[model samples]
Target: MCEEQTVSLVDVLEEDEELEEEASAVLGGSDSDSCSYPQGYVKRQALYACNTCTPQGGEAAGVCLACSYKCHEGHDLYELYTKRNFRCDCGNRKFSGLQCKLYHEKDAVNSQNKYNHNFFGVYCTCRRPYPDPDDQVEDEMIQCVVCEDWLHGRHLGRVVPDCVELQEMICESCMNKNPFLWTYAAHLAGPEVLVEERRDESCANVPKKAEVDDVIEPSCKRSREEVEPSCRLKVLQASQQKRDQSGAVFWPSAWRSKLCSCITCQAQLSAAGLSFLLDELDTVLAYENKGKSSEQVHQGHDPLMSALDNLNRVQQLEIIHGYNDMKTELKDFLQTFAAEGKVVTSEDIRHFFEQQSRKRRRVDAGPFYCS
Candidate 1:
């Protein structure tokens, strides 16, 4: 996390470019320009031909410096250039752990090894045949039925991890299929949609990674690429459909995220929740041990129990929504834990709740939906 309080976005972009060049030099690549950078980051003279401006059977955009394609109105070149990502009115690509769905025009090579825009190849999947939208004459490519766009898979490379390539854009279908990815994407896409955390003004300049003390576990490092190859299983359990004793809905498949699939990642998320619970429980237990009356303990029990129940519910929901099959298993586990003769001690409950909570965090709550 950057500690600098007044760093500008422009400076950050420049730094990324500098870092990219330095990295290329260190790696002994042909040159910094020869290496692939995100489309937006390419220099203007190198990436002027945007697919959005290319017309069927018509000349490409003339105003473009590098190629014939032109950029559409309101497109933020700086954001794309700096961030190496963009969502044009042309449409945003959804990462599906496979190939990108959008058309990726290869940049043309400059003397410095920098490629010009409009030189990107059209990548298709499985050598599907279709018409090229760029020329609109019958050229071989994969056609997206939903969007009616041409996608060349060869340009996307042989294997795209959980990333679907469509129309030179990322495919949303695969992301929509996964719950955690969708939730994370939605939050990243628009912060206004999430419940805002009240941050102290003094901490405005602080980076989030620095504020947190715990070391990140390995499972939490699972990228979308790791999760894309597995087949998603959907559980058809009725208990999964019903609301719990509390006012919470249960979603299945909470453990399928690249992060949640690992036991280590599950532990990390649970520890966070359990830490808070233990603190509250300790405060209550302290007062009780000091000769507090039954009424006090009893009163404390409701709040404590509510917290426990909520934690449990959240865990179950995380598992249910995180992975498809885990939802049914989680529901069964909850029911079994609550049944007669079950060893449901406080410690057991606490441990179970924490384990599940960790998994919830591991499985980003976004992959299931995007609004």
Candidate 2:
């Protein structure tokens, strides 16, 4: 019984080694053959295998996907699955989807999960078949994402891979036919002409007429040299309207008309309009009645307040002028601040004068009052 058991164990070991050898032979073990294609590939392709291990009779049957030589005739290509020698006839080192069942767990819910299976596709890494993937898989074909159609990878360059959870089984040809679906940003039509037309029309009312001849010539002029006064008014009115519509037009000459259309520009113009109102507030706040017993602060409000309250064109101009004056004053204030290392506020100026008055009072003993 002991002798018989030993012989059976030896036979089992021999069978295992034979199986391992067959597995290696199924994968293209030869380093000389390989294939490559740049565009990318997809297919029910023959996996990478070792050319050295492939049998002579197998060469004529189902050709290597990498080299197009049928090395396995009667047997299915996927039967040669194994741990160390997992590869295809094309010399692809990675397992194809057909053989994926043996080594990879199929994730029905999420195929993209790399942990599950390499459902994304196979990559060629065959050392024996140096450029085998190129030689095995046809260059013209690709697995379409939309439809599972095998198409020339070159022709489907226009198609963008959809960002879908499931692989796009449909080919590029089917995608082109669908009205709802189209190509990516690169394939979209040219500049939107309608949008451009709308923008042009927005500033269409702003009249910027060409300059007419300034000098009046005599001696039977061939044509009348007078321009319409109304036309000039229209131009001025347009300029003002454009300014009002867009805000201050200060930019590249081409952009000036469009500048007023921006919301920020409108807000800026509105803020500038408040300058005249602030000026009126200042006049009211100023101290009046310098030297007389009868002198009193003006109880009645300034008439300019009423004008400022109403947002008329004249008020806007006043506001603009005031804004310019304030800008100049601000520049002077900034210079003073830089030199002093502190901002000189209105309260600071008033307090300074108050201190001067206190010094004068301390020095004078007699009743010294200035009217």
lDDT of 1 at 85: 15
My TM-score estimates for the predictions, one after another, are 0.18, 0.15
lDDT of each: 0.30, 0.30
Range of the 10 consecutive residues with the lowest summed lDDT in candidate 1 = 246-255
Model 2 lDDT on a 0 to 1 scale: 0.30
Where is model 2 poorest over a 10-residue stretch in terms of lDDT? 243-252
Candidate 2 all-Cα RMSD: 37.4
How far residue 268's Cα lies from its native spot in candidate 1, in Å, is 22
What C-alpha root-mean-square deviation, in Å, does candidate 1 show against the real structure?
Answer: 30.6
List clash counts for every candidate, in order: 66, 49
